[model samples]
Target: MNRSQYLCLTALAAAIGFASAHAADTTVSADVTAKINTRTMQKTTQFDRFIITYRNGTTERSSATAATQNVTAAVSRAKLHASANATAGSALGVTWKRKLAIGSDLVRTSRKLDRNEALTLMQQIATDPAVAAVEPDVMLHAVKDYVAPASASPGGSAPNDTNFPLQWHMRPGNGTVEKVGRDTTSFANWGGSGASSAWPNYDGSGVTVAVIDTGVIIHGDLNEDYAGAGYDMINDSFVSGRAADGRSPGGWDLGDWTNTEPYITECLDGNASAGEASSWHGSHVFGNIAAVNNNGTGVDGIATHAKVIPIRALGHCGGYTSDIADSITWASGGHVDGIPDNPNPAQVISMSLGGDGTCLASDVSGTAIAGAMARGATVVVAAGNDSEDASSHTPASCPGVVAVASVGITGKRAFYSNYGSTVTVAAPGGGIYANDASSGTQVDAGFVWSTVSSSTTTPDQGTSVTGGMAGTSQATPHVSGIVALMIEAVNEAGHATLTPDQIRLALVNSARNFPNTPDHPIGAGIVDANAAISAAINYNSVAPSIALTSGVAAIASGKAGDAILYRIDVPTGATNLTLRTLGGTGDVSLFAKRGNPPSNDGGNADFKSVKPGNSESIVQTTVSPGSWYVLVVGVKDFANVQVLANYTAH
Candidate 1:
């Protein structure tokens, strides 16, 4: 068909989309010899005019306006052309490009419509017999079109969801939202004295978590106890400093967003002014992630005590995969060859940016991400804002990372938040599309409120300070902070050297599941600092109940392994206990050494002395019966840092 005729036919098809539901099966077949290029059409529409907005501010777009055209005659010509093509048998098959909605008429008939009425309506529409079929309009989540909540003042009488800590909604609040502000947290009321609340000690004094995003703007909130800052990986510059090796800190009055890659032309027209505006996105994200929680001046962070490693990655249009890969490796303390070691090695890496889709085996980004996991760093990635299944996003979909989905204060899924089995947890990331302006009640599904850039303290750090912000980017820091808390709790309990897996499990098991969402929507529910700390603090030793006929606790070398064997049983579900191990500098090992034991201790001889080959029982392995207590003693190993000397008796 001619171009004009084809355009007219397509328009007609669209106009009849809904009306064709009850039409007769009048099929149209055509055969013609023309080379069709599907790929060209696909490419043209791939990223055609996508809609995006500034996450921090608002923008307006006018209603669409298109010039109207009349093509009634053109449609008739296209129909004639189709018939001619069919008769010629140029193409044999009937190609049904559009699947007409055909089930609505049947559904309406089954519902309440009288048979005669349904038939009458169908006949009227199908009289010409050109209509093939019709169906109901498919509905969607209404994400893009959904109106967003209005912004509210930070100080308000009503308990606003935004005012709550980042992951507070994931866990039921200790009380109501109104009471959180009144609590004496470092973030809420820094340095104020009161009885210890849930996370009484969060001053990340010794631990460091990495914030891998746009570089941070060194604001007062983060710099209060800021131990140290690192370099910008996006452009090899020291974080908060002008240049990578420049000794001086960044200059004052710098904005948050930096322009590492300058544009050739500010605007195509000469009248436009040149400036930097996009660099602050990273600074804003970091400010929320680790802006000293409860410093008594600015907003509260999930971990007020934790320190951060700012690994700058994003800049310009978006960060490159190579740069991001390098940042991830460096932050995790992995070697990048001759480069200087990361001054602040993070135990966890928080990445708030992500691209769409699942990772292919050949995906370079996915492979590099795995490198970070191998280095013992816990990675947290954001499920994108597309609201589609996360199976289609990279980095987030990459295995060995925790995928975070957004939730609002009301505990509902944010309309735009993506979800899937890959999601390990959910947090409050505010949605901007829907809301009540007067009430400042935005959809609370995924709103995570935290600090953002207010002004730039360093000329080189870019000129941004602290301010209010929200996003999964904002919510993720909450999880990172909880990880920091878990580390702190474990360290305080004396297990300062915990494996990544142990830390991950403790955090996951202790999360608070939301009442409204019971499944994959919120991975294991929201993060709970109090529950996690409680579990870590009360860890205990257990004795296995498995029966053994006989076993010997052996010890080799001069290390403290050849000492104790005391058989003690523990009750089920019990979590606290005290046990004795061989003391003093002498090499001695304490083992509950599993196996059947002699009916009785060899009286005083077994208790005080050791036979050449007989198992020695020196230490008292004490605990309630039924729990398993095995060998635990400090032994010197030639190769390993610590080794199992031999299972001895206690």
Candidate 2:
């Protein structure tokens, strides 16, 4: 059955009080409850898939065949119970699916069994002396709500990109007509502050951001910025409806739309109704982060010059957490069996996909994230769209990842966005229902526009299209793009590449304050693209040389037109303090300030030296008993200058 037919049935079911609200857990109907009570529910015994890790040196062999044989031997030794009449190979059927880089195996039984029966079988298998760890292959769905939208136009001020007008998240309200109802007062001049403003200075030229989702489709806007076709983790040939064996080389988006028949048979369990459309979710997310810039056709990406490393993990009906974990490890330059090393290791990994669960160290997804962070890849994830605390979700709840929440054009918490202390920041994810009373209908005015496809089929899909989509899925990429810009700025500044923690710090410190305080903290604030870039560019050590008594100190204000800040502690009863710019070829000015520098330099300065030439001085008979700041400005583009601070204290 098609999705439309399924939706009609679902609406009818809802009217009859049969279907409950959609959530993470499965909903059971009265009929199913009666069947279970009577022990009449069809009990089928199916082989359960398990991810098993063997003891050290037990499964890691020179060849793939050897490793498989060793794992099989270990399973055989466990002597799991099976039917007495079963054939040799079919009895206790243990088949190897794949080898993992972390010395584990994806194993499955050939027999079909019920859930309880399968659990019993797995428990017996786990007791094997050779088995180090084992877990059922749990499924994880894409964390986004995929709704096909009506037509819409791009809105922003970028001249070359025609779709810029639709990109409300990229620019401030510069009195442009396109930004009419977009919370101009609160979010005005806040858009693209750190990110878009830094474009001319640094466009993430040398950085690579990995989009780990349903894979990326190369559109006109994203073609030129492609780093390469990354690896595909969904090894199923039937999933993409293409006859390809094993996990293929290229990261391509095969449609993930579910038909009504399957939605009823599998998802709804012959009771529930409704199906979903193909999201082309990865493509939309990719466009937000690295779509080619100034391309006449579509919207401008935040990190226009950065190359995208497309890594396909989620596929039909979402994906298994095991596959998602493997993709994360592989994307961040970790080793994965059967695939070649990732040539373009990502500096920033964007995961707009997640599942409902707390992140634990024992879980594959959490372990993979830790590995990615250890390798210095900054991971940005969507704080789930459940509108509940994000701490209940995996990946977002995982420690060290930048969990992003959603806000609308009004600069308020998006009604659907998940909140909690776990969220690192919030970005424009669009809230269509803000103005409209209609709960679920599309509103063109309140959405994030990006690249998408109109086709719903596997082959001969629709041509390139752009429109609005809303979710934490949209917010995740905004932070990813900003991080790309930050990384670029840091690299250009001749500083060592920033670690994941440092990048998070820069983003948190540089975020803009929220217009209205949210009930729960979304993050430091909305991510300021311009401020984050500035933070990255201006990152310097806070340590200052201690001023000594009767000494000539030499220092160079690193760059022209830059301010060098210095601090000195004036102890009690200290006397005769003098600070001055002694010599330099170019004009240099000095100021003695008591507190933070004000908007203008006039009121805050206790003393200022604006001499006619390259020298200036400030002297005080009795020094104050507290900390004092010395500000040095390069008036005439001075590269190096000499300064002296002499004091006599008893």
Please give the lDDT score for candidate 1.
0.40
Residue 190 in model 1: lDDT? 15
Query: What C-alpha lDDT do the candidate models reach, one value each?
Result: 0.40, 0.64
| Regions of model 1 farther than 4 Å from truth | 1-197, 224-228, 236-276, 360-363, 431-447, 454-466, 518-520, 535-650
Q: What is the lDDT of candidate 2?
A: 0.64
Error in Å for residue 315 of model 2: 1.7
lDDT over C-alpha atoms for residue 323 of model 2:
76
TM per prediction:
0.50, 0.69
Write the residue-wise lDDT of candidate 2 on 1-650 in tens digits: 11111010000112121212122113333222211111111122233466666667654433456545554554465344355333344346666777665555676665544444444344444445555555555555566643434434333233467666556777642323344233342233332223456567767788988998888765777754453558778865544445784787778787776655554455435554444667788988988987777767777788877878888777665665567778888888999878898888899999887755555444456578879989889999998777877766667777668889887666777777888766777887776553412264445545677887767754246777776777788888999998998888778789877778667756765677676777666766788787778777766632222343345676655445556656565554578888877665777778764312211122235578988655788899976544455677676677557777777766
TM-score: which candidate is best? 2
